[model samples]
Target: MTTIVPPKERECERCGRTDTWNDDTGTWAVVERDGDRLSGDPFCLHEWDINGAYNPLEEGA
Candidate 1:
C-alpha cells in the first residue's frame, strides 16, 4: 500500500503571503497578499505584509 499526500499551502516567511500548488498551471502561485495569484514574487523587501522587519543579518553574524 502507498499513501499520497497533497501539497500543503505555502506562506511567505517574509510577508505571510500564502500560495497553493496549482495542478493545472503546474506551478506554485501566490494566492494572498497584494499579488494574489499574479505571480510568485510576493516579497518585495520594500513592502512586507507580515509582522517584523526585514533583517539582513547573515547566519552566525
Candidate 2:
C-alpha cells in the first residue's frame, strides 16, 4: 500500500493571501474573505518559505 500525503495549506507572507488545497479538483483555491471567494486582486510574487526547518513528508517515504 502506498500513502498519499497532500499539502493542506499555504500562505503568501508578502500579501497575506492564504490558499487551501482541494483534493477533489486537484488545485489550490483562494480562501474565502469578505463574504466572497476572491481571485487575483493584488498579484504578488509568491515566495514560498520552504526551508530546512520544515519537513512534513520525511517519514517512511
Candidate 3:
C-alpha cells in the first residue's frame, strides 16, 4: 500500500516547477511540456507526493 503522507514539494532545477515524489521510478520529477523521465539526478528521498503528473523525459530537452 502506498503511504499517503504530506510530501514535501520542490521546484525543479530545469523547469522550476513544483514536483512531488514519484513511486513508480522512485524519484522526484516535475511535469514539463516535453514528457516524463528520470532526470538521472538525485532528488528522490522517499518524502514525495504522487499528485504530480508522470511523463517520460525526452532524449534531449
Candidate lDDT values, in order: 0.47, 0.60, 0.47
Off by over 4 Å in 3: 1-8, 11-16, 33-61
Q: Model 2, range 1-61, lDDT digits (tens) per residue?
A: 9965655776766666677767787666788888766443476775434442444443332
Kindly report which residue stretches of model 2 are placed more than 4 angstroms away from their true locations once superposed.
1-5, 34-41, 49-61
Top model number, lDDT:
2
* Cα lDDT of model 3 by residue, 1-61, tens digit: 8965645445544433556557777665564446754343454332222344433342322
lDDT, candidate 2, equals 0.60
For residues 10-57, what per-residue lDDT tens digits would candidate 1 score against the true structure?
555555556556777665556655534534353444232333233222
Itemize residue pairs with steric clashes in candidate 2. Answer: none
In model 1, residue pairs whose N, Cα or C atoms come closer than 3 Å (at least 3 residues apart or on different chains), thus clashing, are: none
Per-model TM-score, in order, reads 0.42, 0.56, 0.29
- Higher-ranked by lDDT: 1 or 2: 2
Worst 10 residues of 3 by lDDT: 52-61
Error of 1 at 61 (Å): 22
- Candidate 3 TM-score, true structure as reference: 0.29
